[model samples]
Target: MPPAHAVTWRNGFKSAFWIANVLELFERFAFYGSKAVLAVYLANTIGLGAQTAGSLAGLYSGLIFSLPIIAGTFVDRYGFRRTLMACFAMFSLGYFLIGLGGMSAGQGLVQALGKTGYITSVLVLTAIGGSLIKPCIVGTVAKTSHPDVKALGYSIYYTLVNFGGAVGPILALQVREGLGIEYVLVMSSLVSLLLLLGTFLFFKEPEVEPIGGNPRTLGQVFRDMLLVFGNFRFISFLVIFSGFWIMFWQIFYSFPFYVTDVLQFPRFELMETIDAWTIILVGVPMTALVKKWRPITAMTLGFALASFSWLIVAGSPTVMAAIVGIALFAFGEATQAPRFYEYVAGLAPKDQVGTFMGFAFLPVAIGSFVGGPLGGWLVQHYLRDTMNPAMMWYIVAAVGFVSTALMLLYNKFFAPREAS
Candidate 1:
């Protein structure tokens, strides 16, 4: 018989899962806190052009999603506790450097390195740190949850992540407005310090089964990656899905510019915070309503809803429209994201499960890499140079509409169905 059930959030989940979840919260806190304000900081404070700022932010975000193949191998070898500690330390160092650099430019510290040089270096450091954290925390969740409660565990984990995304920007707004932009980075560094301490004291590596083959060498990892690339159907589907993200990522790359530069709104960060809040409030109900829907159908609707969200902003130049758009976007995210992951995991052949899972991030990386400069260029040419600022949203909506159509076509032709 199982040991007497402990009074806890969930009966079967191990303490390690909760610990990993808490750590994920802090990790996201630092990350989103920095991200929510980064585009504006680059353009306004660093005095970089919008195109330059968006491109830099895109490169950083793309690498963070893409570099986990290498990082996961290191984590497998080095163990989770050490890897988590290193990641937190790197976050602290990166955020601290950005804060110090921004605060000390006139004093010649930041200027000594060149303004762009210092900022880019900070981003590179954070990307390396961010890349490592995703695999470690999600891997922990996968290891610690009992099979019966595994889905619930991930649901809770995602909810906490969205919660952190919500809280991070609110805290950033307060720090940036009440304190200063420099203090916002300092705040992120402080959160990283807490995570480092937590990792050292409480992060006991959970027990998990070993892989069937020999430990993954770098050569083996590369070979596995190439194998994934050789699967044409899978690669094509992922590329098609990447179009959604190409549009979605504009929240980070384009929304702030659209609000502040075009709409003349002072509270652009409010739009960022709204999506997270909507996720927190209605995610459960929305998920329940769509639980029986086909994954492809749900995803197509998600794209449609999210695509239409931009129309609210395009038609009206009010902050309220932007807020409503973000809320709608959040509901759309709730409809599609969970099902999307399930679909991807189901597609993997048994021997290639690990390989396929790692490649799952490829679409995200591709989207950011493509989206960043594209968003910047759109804002620069259509919004700043011309009278039709709203044309940017139309372009973003077009991407989403095309992606939704592609998903439907893939479903008809390629997707494996329950009836199949």
Candidate 2:
């Protein structure tokens, strides 16, 4: 076989790879677009308190990350194309219902559950749909790309993901400003509807040899989950790593309220866009620079950088400062995010690498679950009650600092030397 460098990108990847990635781009676009304004919409338009809105938003995000484990199992059972079609269908319905609930228009169920409950229910539905996307896209990439060019395939995937993330919020800003916040959900629904059609028309399941032989039964999947959870070391690492996401999630959970409510900034979503754009611009070079570092060491540095970024905003409470702070945080994210999976794979038992990797998303779920209420409380206490909003970022930065210190200690003590 020729060396990977000899292979042309056009020859190394199949049509399915391109299709899957394109779908992933718009899926992310739909998701982030709605998410950019969800907190503000909940608090301002739907009449939920800041804390309640945060909690709901957190619940939605947490579910989106957490459900993929089970959802992946379903994808394995059902074909990818069929599962994707169902997922997009749910996405369309869920987003539309959320918008309808926001407008106080649903008749039977909306009236029965009330607006808050209806919206919450729809959010959960939407999250379930969102859960199916990543596994399908990733599986397609793996199946469709030649072994020689799989890494490049994933690089392309990551670039599109960031591109979608950057553009989604910009679009959200336009939609929210021109139409209304609730129409953001409508926009998401429309995007999903288009994706549903695209999937039906263009997406084909990539054929590849199954890894680890035939698919396991749902019973076996559950058993594997239990076995993974039984590994105290793995579980402990996941719990510790969750601190980064807890800090990271604040950009969405609290930063929106801080920008609009505290700084009187109208384009808070634009600030959110800065993080994605930074990652897109800096991620490749940053990855190249740290390609030789130990995973734990890189992660420790990333945690420290992300933590310190909040202090930048806290020191100077202005739009430029917020922009700079978010950019810094994105740099930290770009540094550690790729290495995280590498570290997890190294830590896993060789026989259960896939199982362990599946559980790696746990930290994201845990972070959202915890960070939401914590962010809401910070906003309430520091931003609203005490009238000292800068303290909120201080607390956020402190959380990152503590997490970074813990990571350093973990590297020194518990981390395998190979990983460290």
**Reference-based TM-score of each model:** 0.92, 0.95
What are the candidates' C-alpha RMSDs? 2.6, 2.2
* Backbone-clash count (model 2): 0
Where model 2 places Cα greater than 4 Å from the true spot, the runs are 1-6, 107-111, 210-213
Write model 2 residue lDDT over 139-184, tens digit each, in one string: 8998888988899998999899889989999999999889988899
Instruction: Give each model's whole-structure lDDT.
Output: 0.82, 0.87
* Poorest 10 consecutive residues by lDDT, candidate 2: 101-110
What lDDT does candidate 2 reach at residue 67?
A: 86
Number of the top-ranking candidate, with TM-score as the measure: 2
| Candidate 1 lDDT by residue in tens digits, 20-63 | 89999888878888888887777777777778788888888999
> Could you give me the TM-score of model 1 versus the true structure?
0.92
